[model samples]
Target: MEERYALLLERLTKTEPEFQKAYRDSLDMSWIYHDSALEGSVYTAQELKAAMDPTAPIVTDSSIQPICEEIRRHREALEYIRDFADKKRQPLNIDVVKKIYLILHPEEGDIKTVKYRKDIPQHRLYFHEYAPPDKITYKVRQVLDWVNDPETRRTRSTIRIAARAHYDLLRVFPFASDSGKVARLFMNLLLLRGGYPPAIVHSTERQRYYEALKGSSATMTQIVHESIENNLGSVEKLLEGHESKGYAVKV
Candidate 1:
């Protein structure tokens, strides 16, 4: 699994620089959301893929700066976290998220939200409908501890580790509005750096996706394993008929 992931990363890195730039730009644009401006509007996976076309219409340089900065910070933090994991020989760290939050929202203080209830256990199950009474800042330290814990550092397989890291963090719900966005970015960063192809669970998949995560406390291991297996299978299929031609960029 590790070998395959490494090979894919090498291939991705070696892709034409112009294509890489375009692909990265596409990723950045797809993540931005706005209710008013075209540049700010929410993008579905299909729209995002269509927008990736080098020939497709797009907002100009002036419109893309803010979103680009956020993407840059995300990728930069991802690189840092990947390096830290390799050097420290540990599971993903929560400090990485803190660093990312600061980079993405430097002026912002704690993310405001309702507080968690006293009746709920700190490590207990997630309540989707009930909003926690506290803001995101309150959970930062706890998130850090959860990731850096020695018991969570197991590495029998890269896929398993990466997938579980993603699922567990999603369940943890460390951020207010950005949990899904952060998880997707963080997971792809790990996959790309740790030698796997980037995977995005589209909004279209939200229902099954949440269902898959619903029993997370008891089903995390199984869910992670299944997700990894499925992702790896897709990679294998992509390799079977892969061509550099399809991904070429005009810019």
Candidate 2:
């Protein structure tokens, strides 16, 4: 899996830079749509897909406002996260995480005001209780420290970091709103910074996605790796067929 991943990354660099930019932009749509859907979006995948295309005709419907607004916010947040993730050379830290949380839900509050919750929160459906409010800040710092520690970097696999980090964020449940989106965004930031593709959790696989996060098992990591592989595979197939055409990859 690693070998194939490396090969695909090498191939990506060979594609036209303009095409690569467009391809990456398209991924923004996929990540936002699927992530929002997991949070109980009522919009169909096709509807969400069409919504992202500027050329698609806009029809007003107050009934679908919830899903549309969710998608709109998620798309903006993911774009900002990717831009920051691509340029930063420093280790991931609490500040970075908070910035992402703020981006994901700007309506909640500003940077300083929207720090970790000062009260406990619970995930009833999953029966997962977050760390107590008093402990949330410290535990979050520890996770960031692990990401930056040279020893952990040398010993831990990206799968472990990505999977465990996702698991930990869910357990921490740090933000007042959009904690789930922030968690997924932070996970993808790590992967992208490490020279890997985004580990998108498809909405169609929400059952498995939730169960994997709940179990915190190899299956979760496996699902992530598969998403990355699937992304690369699509690009590989695209280049094979349209190497000279400079194709735009659809999400």
Who wins the TM-score comparison? 2
Residue 181 in model 1: lDDT: 49
Predicted candidate 1 versus true structure: per-residue lDDT over 1-251, tens digit per residue: 66766765566575677655754564444334221122123544445444344565564566554554454454455455456545544445555554555555555554342322333245423334322446334554554564456565563444455565666566656654445545555665565556555554444444555665665533544544454556566555544444434754233
How much lDDT does candidate 2 score? 0.74
- Provide the clash count, candidate 1: 9
Per-residue lDDT of candidate 2, residues 1-251 (tens digit): 55666777677677778767777656766677677777775467656755666666674776666556667667777776678777867657787888887765676677677767776544443446678888888889888887788888799887668777877887788876667778888888888767677888888878887787667557778888878778777777866876657565442
- Root-mean-square deviation of every model: 7.6, 4.0
Give per-model TM-scores.
Answer: 0.55, 0.81
- The candidate that wins on lDDT is 2
**Candidate 1 wrongly placed segments (more than 4 Å):** 13-15, 26-41, 44-93, 109-143, 186-193, 217-251
Lowest lDDT sum, 10 consecutive residues, model 2, at: 120-129
Per-prediction backbone clash count = 9, 0
TM-score, cand. 2 vs. native: 0.81
The TM-score obtained by model 1 is 0.55
